[model samples]
Target: MERRGTRAAVRTATGTVRRPERTATDEDWPAACREAVLGGAGLLAALTALDGAAGSLDPLRGGLWAALAVTLFALLLPPRVTAGQGWLSARGPLRRRTVRTDRLVSVRWSEGIAQRLVLRDDTGRRLVLDPRVLLANPALWHLFATGARTAQASGALLCGATALRQLTERAEERTARTLLAGSGRA
Candidate 1:
């Protein structure tokens, strides 16, 4: 379906039209990362505060210390998760990638420490994008996965396998260039 800039157009082989409801944006990446870092920091701060407040000489001091620790951690930690157009971008301690809906070939759900989204190109090379930093929102993650599947099924709006492969190759080349540049070799 063809719409204005607000929606993605999907065309069938017979020239039928469909409009996709969701699109991805770039902001989702850093937000997810910040959330993860803050959460970890909060936990550490809480534990530290508890230890500091606990008195070696007083028995009641242990409970008091624990309460103080929890309070401080809650005050210091902030939630970070944002939704974007066409894609769910997330950044955490070890994750950094923009998952383009058009480039996604498959989505898999698992009961693990993190949720995994597998993207593939024409050559069958795959990139595993995991947004594990935000373990608080399983629903949102599921929504993103479902959206990816929907986008993949819509033939008109999906990227061709060959095009995806070229994109992957280009990305690798760019990474190499970046590394070389940093090393004073580019």
Candidate 2:
């Protein structure tokens, strides 16, 4: 049996495995550029145009406008998402959130302007993340998939297994398509 420090392995319906939450590597990053600079620049320009020059406005008013412009520009910045062996993290300029991907007990999908991946782990901690984070990072996706599968096999998963299945199928399909497309002679 494999060992991860002093933490004992936990048995699941499939078999015994090391404590994933502890054994898995931390994955997540901040400062991931989403190339929103252009939009942010336009926003800053538009706000400045609408509000007029900082020099022309009263001192306090100019300072407030400058602050607002900076805030808006910062908001337009892209957030970074990372997933490691057992963890998933999303970092933004304003805040950073993380979840133990390998310990997740429940996952729910919420649709909105941006799709939300709501996850709850054994520790009672909750994380709301972008579903695109998984779609974009295969390594991160695998960590969650493994944990979800374990949870499913153990009957600890309350919901969203079907959604995970669909996502897996889609990922597999894309992989097959890419492989086939590139297999032929040029």
Q: Kindly report which residue stretches of model 2 are placed more than 4 angstroms away from their true locations once superposed.
A: 1-34, 49-61, 111-113, 181-186
Q: After superposition, how far is residue 20 of candidate 2 from its true place, in Å?
A: 15
How far in Å is the alpha carbon of 21 misplaced in model 1?
A: 12
90-113 per-residue lDDT for model 2 (tens digits): 667788877776667778877669
lDDT (10s digit) by residue, model 1, range 35-153: 65566566556655666666342446655655655555444433333334445554433444445554465544343665553555333545454444222343444445455555656
Worst 10 residues of 1 by lDDT: 133-142
Candidate 1 lDDT = 0.48
TM-scores of the models, in the given order?
0.31, 0.66
lDDT of 2 at 4: 42
Cα miss at 151, model 1 (Å)? 3.3
Clashes of each: 11, 2
Cα displacement (Å) at residue 65, model 1? 16
Model 2: per-residue Cα lDDT at residue 65: 57
